[model samples]
Target chain A: MGKQVPVAEGVFTWPSDEPRLIGSKCTDCGNVMFPTQSGCPKCSGQTTETVELGRTGTLWTWTVQGYPPKSPPYAGDASPKTFEPFGVGYVELPGEVKVETRLTVSDPEHIEIGMEMELTFVPLYTNDDGDEVVTFAFAPTAS
Target chain B: MTTDDVAIVGIGMHPFGRHEGVSGMDMGVSAVRTACADAGVEWSDIQFAFGGSAAAGNPDTMVSKLGLTGLQFINVVNGCATGGSALFSAYNSIKSGMFDLGIAIGFDKHERGAFRVNTRSSGLGDWYGESGMALTTQFFGMKINRYMHEYGISNDSLARVSEKAFRNGSKNENAWRRKPLSMDEVKESAMLSYPLTQYMFCSPGEGGVALILARADQAHKYTDTPVYLKSAVVRSRRFGSFEVMAPSVALEHNAGPTVDASAAAFEMAGIGPEDIDVAQLQDTESGAEIMHMAENGFCEHGEQEHMLAMGETEIGGRLPVNTDGGCLANGEPIGASGLRQVYENVLQLRGDAGERQVPNNPKTAYTHVYGAPGISGVTILAK
Candidate 1:
């Protein structure tokens, strides 16, 4: 595989032994958010501190993408010929926020709500620079 | 209190389906002409106007086709609540005594897969879309999945909702999906998102709808059977509420905006859910209808299963919903969607709806529209 790289910068800590999703917590309202927002949505305060979020969370809810999404917006190979269904869901990092992410499994029967899930990474696609770009996901903790 | 005396005098719609050669504005112009004729008024009679479309261009530009009477025309573009917001603007125009008469209009022509949103344009992070997590259907799926698990809603109930939409669509001439499909067909249709089948979702399509509003006291001057606009309310989602296009949600699942809009509509109308004779709830997909029934105060959370099993939402049932078929059948032209509900409600109130009319001469009707970025609008009409 080509040198591993994150799909985008600032979403999570990269090039590390243990990467945790990056987020922001409001100093005023204590409301937390993903990917680190500069402003606090909860308290209308610009005062927010960048923080590393919990790596483990519970699967709050889930569903599978039965069809390939449209491109220009979608970077993955969405051609009908090679498209494979994948799971999408929200994972609740306790006392923080329920982060919407891609799930490791596609079959509905395989996953259940409230299943303990942990942060993981999957190859989204390859960049032109010969780097294997990756994206974040949550998987069954026991898996 | 200044806005309590508005009435819809006339309603018109350009049958919602594919019209290859027709531009969205052309449809809007035709609907405007028909509405004026139905109200027995000339285009010059309207003192102000508010209308909108998403894919379609600025609505105020229609003044060229509508004749340059130089009326104050405002353009609204509130995602799915575009039509409702336009109507609210027009209702207030007359209710506030600023104008004697006005028009609220909406129209749109969307690409076949137009429901697929581009997160980039919405100011979302690029990675959110690039990583294949931007699908709107996924949001609907997760939400319904969670709701069903929490409320004990059977898979069969989801199919039943689409089954009902198709059955009702078959009876409405203007609806796009006219052919009725069985519950089994709904259940068996290719799963677009788990718990939601292909047939369970609405395709994006073309259409236009317009309503003419006047002060309730002067409504009789135009139409003898004026339907009073008892209330028109729009509400946005609170921070903790689970809504579309969210990368993360709050742990505390607060009520969505529909609950707020629904309650406010009933409050402004001086009536409760039980008093509404018939209704049209947003049915973007089968699951939305199921959830909205309770969100709009039609029933309890877990009662949808029993309600679907008993056909309580059917045309002849206790509370007829989407009597002219909803987005699940008519398809969604986001701009025109909300007003289409109001159009159907007006027909029901006037007893002008032919074979699909609700029984016992329905005196009151409610229309609700909910959509992207988490907003809901509700309108109550009374005869």
Candidate 2:
């Protein structure tokens, strides 16, 4: 097993038992954004503050990525022989914003809209330095 | 109310498909020359021009081929609305009383396979594409999936849209995909994304289109049967609309840009949807056609399932849509797709469409095109 590392920095909290995704909130109009944008889209507010997003949300919409995406833009290191289809969806964190993320499910029979989902980290690929590069995802709540 | 004040005197197109040796600029020159011949005007006669393309070289650099008459040539690059923007510019120029005649030409040659977008150029972070969530087809799947869930639309209705596209394509000579397809074949095709089949999507290819615009008062001097441009409008997405390459969406819901563009076009033309005799909508995929049908106000949401089943959108039906095959059969030469719609509508209004002509003389035509980052353009024409 290689050492674990986040795919990118400033996306989520590190070294924490409760890893909440980081986002931004407009101090002017109270709009919420993921990945912490510079300005507020709703009110054009220049002043904003970073805030941790909710850990759980409900699935708003979803689809199966039935084929491997094209490379150059996609850095998953997926080849035709080893690639697996994945699920993509938007998870609404209630009253804040709906964040687009990779779902932990692929089969249409397994996923449903409005299902309870919780944010989790998963290995996206391995780097050349033998580090496991992980990204964010949402999975169906175990209940 | 400025209705029918601008007229399209001539239209021309280079066939849409894989042209092995043809460069995008060559096709553009070919289309412009053909339009000149159709309008009985020389290249030197065009006082100004507007043109664009996504992959092809700049349009303003074609002065060597078009003649050095010192004409004002502006280049437009509105992603997929390149042609519409060009037309919009030319129409406004004539209406502005600055120029009496002008031309709008668009052409593009895209490489094979899916388009590889540059994240930095699109103002997106590297993680977006790096995480495997940037595929265009995936967004379409999620959109139609949510639409189906909300409006009770069926997958069968989605397949029917493609089925109708190919059938209409078979009747047109210049369309790229001329072979008609059955609904079952569309359903059974390869599933690249959920709720969409390979046969249901339009492939990016090569082509060129040009339309000569003249003031209505002077149009009779060139062509007696002029197709008048009643209105043309372009709009961008509002907040809460689901657009391509978005990391998040507002919980608040709103209609897409197509709704606003369609409404403004109808209002500017001083007419309503009921007055349109035929329509040419952006059919990037089968599901897009269905969604646009309602977004453009041709029908109500959730009514598509019944409307598509009743065959009211067919060539011989109540509303003829994409009679010249649209983007599905024409292939999307990004810059040229919008003008292709206008070209087909002109053919229909002039009774020049050989096999795909709508019955009872379609006097008014509506055209709409939607593109990435959420932009839409709508145009209305009447004879």
Candidate 3:
């Protein structure tokens, strides 16, 4: 594998300046799925295409990570002192697509399903060579 | 509480195992063919079809695996509950009066290992671990430890459940794991999850199960005594575990999907615990079956061990559960398990379950099917 970059390439990106997540739309069922996929689960026939989603969405659910997850694919250390309580929640976009991602709020109690939120880029952590690794998260949008 | 009437006229299973030659479509064809033969109906006679599959290798390219040619319906891949999802879809289609007969088919030829939904397409959540955390065995392992901490249930009781299932499975030609296992042997088995021995966790297997749903009038043409679908209820997790209450049966506390779904099914079926003569509960882990019993109202909360010790759930007991040895003995076919449980329940109610058959010959039976990540589907069938 190539050296880890500031941002992982081939992770998917939108064409426009507006921050948005990527997904695949099923032409057969009109259903949309996030993180992009090759096929639809409902019709199992049609192939999927990389479609851009709205930058803003509603919070479908939220939870605070009580403990660090044990697997990789994440870039941070699990030191209790350094690792802050990270919150994860489901953000519902326009179609039926619901994306699960890290939340940008502090207190998890305030988060609830149907709460309006917007996508915001956040620095996940620093890499071995001191490159600032960044990722996308959702934050409550001011009404 | 009464819903639309539905009846199961035919049910068939291709014995579960690791077969190198047959693909998922081949398995589906075998199962569908058997079900048609058993129901004495022609394939063209069916009006609709619902396909359930999970790890379909080259799934996108293989649409005809389920024999869904001209039939119009849905295809669901809901992790472990795939079969239940298909059953629900088929039931709804038949209930709509659009078709006189509906076929629900599920097939999976997975190699022994973990299961994961590629989030890249569905983007619901981050991809779970491959061999470590994402595996259903490890997920149930975590739940098993928590259940032991809360319930103080004994290892012996769990072993007894496994032993009974293995003994029963030995007689089932269609079961994947058919070897007889003793309680001592179960207890001595290697540890896959703490407080749950290897025998306690369900082993992955390959299998296909097919069910034929028809109108009550048409059902008699296929089988003498039809297994009517009194209700098929699915409970979904509206939110994450953070919002869910601590493990308790209190309506306020989150009893998880199992309790909620079972309650809905019971209401729809217009039946209570007293009316149920048999149950085929998902015991992917020992705690699952025991906890589900209380949730499904088979017994009071935290009283499963006592009931088991009293032989209340045995073949001759008040509520004979898993008369066909549940996942504990049958081997977890992942996608095929939901319909497999229904097949067993119907067999018992029809008095066709040879050695493992309940003596009373049940009139009303329930199957509480659950998945690892938190999904429950309950189906109640009446003779």
Candidate 4:
């Protein structure tokens, strides 16, 4: 479930006590990129600092998945026997950055775009050692 | 302004679908042959050529597939606007007095899987690592979220757009998905991306479209009552920024809180939204069609749902849009979709749309093509 790969080096740590995604911020343009870009796209300046993303945000829009994604890159650990149609949505942090992730909610019909949401990590797939590889996901904030 | 600018003399299209047997080059050549025949011209008469395609393996390979015969060939690729980009290239070449005759061909046969990446390129790094960032569907999902926040629009409104598109597509011979759909059906469909159901997104269809552009002075020599290009304008977003401005789509007639490229297009065309008798907007996705209604100045932002409720965007509505059943129904072939819009406008203006035709003869019409991230192209045509 953890690896010290180049993309994850320094910026990302495995099983942190506090779960969050690490992004490099370009102080010049105030732009934050995921998977951490070495430099800012706006000013061509190096990303001087690293930052952690908030675990809570607002749902921008959402829908339920009816089919498996075509690529293996997205194949998750849930067995077809255990697979249930799940909802997905985009959550907007107050900072204007948006991300796409799975939605955890009781009912898909009630999901709306502007609803408040919180982030959680979900296992996407299992590796050779049968360890679960988790990724960030989101769910509706409790009313 | 005296009709010496440009005219489309020939229009041809390959059937839209998942064509596994034919290469993009084969499709483009087939469409070009038909267009040349329709225009009563020989291959040698094509003084200039422009090729458009999104995923043809290689850009140069796709352009070379057209076999230009060394007659001033140009290649253009602008995501979904590939067809429009090609058209614009030929139109400009003729308008610039460089050539009196030109051909624009757009073709595509999308790969049957996730989008590919150029990891092999030396410059690949940074924002380029995650190819998912460029996925148009996710970007539009964000816009839908904002639309919901500002307008309080309901999902039913978005579903209805698909309902209309599916119904129309079912009747279209060239459409990919022929089954008619209901709002409930659309609502229940599998989610491809948040805020975008499978029905809302355009399925990749393999096809090619060819258009012959002749200078205005020579237009009469080709055909009478030629379709005139009022204006062709394109706008692109500032790279490396998250700033979302008003989209430039030309659907809305009223200004909203958002900013778009349509205002400038209207000013250039010397006509307002009210003057447009027919418009063929790029409806790559259902939410996009609804959003375009506001972004293009057809109505205020977030007013699209109510407008749809009133049956305003239907074929017989006050503002008939996507009369040929938009990309959702007709199938989107990326590079060919834009020219397909122009072809539909030409048919409507020429009084040949058949069963799906608009009632009154439309003298003025508009076609808009948008692409990945934030690229917009608006073209005004008149008879």
Writing each residue's lDDT as its tens digit, candidate 3 over A1-143 gives: 22323244323362235656666777776667655667765567467777777788776545454333343434454564676555555566755566656677746356655789998766655667766665667889987
Which one wins by lDDT: 2 or 4? 2
Name the runs in model 2 displaced over 4 angstroms.
Answer: B1-4
DockQ of each: 0.81, 0.81, 0.04, 0.23
Ranking by TM-score: 1, 2, 4, 3
List candidate 4 stretches off by more than 4 Å: A1-11, A29-35, A38-48, A75-87, A104-106, A109-119, A139-143, B57-68, B111-142, B191-196, B239-259
Give the number of colliding residue pairs in candidate 3: 2
Full-model lDDT for every candidate? 0.90, 0.90, 0.70, 0.69
Between prediction 2 and prediction 3, the one with superior TM-score is 2
- Stretches of candidate 3 above 4 Å error? A1-143, B1-4, B57-69, B116-132, B238-253
lDDT of 1 by residue, B1-383 (tens): 23448889988899898999999988899889999999999999898999899987899999999899988899999998999999988887777778888999999999877366767777698899899988778888888999998999999988888888888889889999899999999999899988899998888899999899988888889998999998999999987899989998987778989999999999998999999999999988899999999999999999999988998899999999899889999999888999999999999989888878998999999999998889999999999
- For each candidate, what TM-score against the reference? 0.98, 0.98, 0.70, 0.84
> What tens digits encode model 3's per-residue C-alpha lDDT throughout B137-221?
4345444444554677777778878877777778787777789888888889865544567787776678888999998767788
**CAPRI rating of model 3:** incorrect
Question: For model 2, what TM-score is found for chain B?
Answer: 0.98
Question: Candidate 2 lDDT, tens digit per residue, B145-255?
Answer: 899999999989989999999999999888999999999999999887887888888999999999999989889778878999999999998888898778889999889
Two-chain DockQ for model 2:
0.81
Cα misplacement distance, residue B260 of candidate 4 (Å):
3.7
> Candidate 2: which pairs clash?
none
The RMSD (Cα, Å) of candidate 3 is 10.7
